[model samples]
Target: MKLSFLGQSYEASNPAIAATDTGETLTFRGKSYSQKQFNVALRQPTEELTYRGVRYHR
Candidate 1:
């Protein structure tokens, strides 16, 4: 999906988006971002992201 963050737009695809550090960190297209950044950028549900075998509660 297309998302905007920090006044920048990016195209995020499936499986490429994941989170670590207990949902504190988000990785997109090989670039690492904070959960807050991702949340602001993402227009879709957080459930669409792949976690570390755990469900993320945001």
Candidate 2:
């Protein structure tokens, strides 16, 4: 999966991404750098997930 934060001008490749509402602050990791509220949007759904032999939430 990949994540792009327009507010922060930052990009990341992983299952998750984080950033703040203000463009001044953002983080590629799961943590955000700005105090402003931020919204996270997933670009792609997980290909597959397993939980105790059962499929995880699609």
Question: Of the candidates shown, which would achieve the greatest TM-score relative to the real structure?
Answer: 1
Off by over 4 Å in 1: 16-58
Q: Please give the lDDT score at residue 21 for candidate 2.
A: 60
Give candidate 1's error at residue 28 in angstroms: 34
Residue 15 displacement in candidate 2 (angstroms): 7.9
After TM-score superposition, what is the CA distance of residue 27 in candidate 1 from its true location, in Å? 34
Clashes of each: 0, 0
User: Which residue runs does candidate 2 get wrong by more than 4 Å?
Assistant: 1-37
Model 1, span 1-58: residue lDDT tens: 9999999787776544443445577789999976642222344554444368866643
Candidate 1 lDDT for residue 23: 57
By summed lDDT, which 10 consecutive residues of candidate 1 come out lowest? 36-45
Clashing pairs in 2: none
RMSD of each: 16.5, 13.4
lDDT of 2 at 47: 49
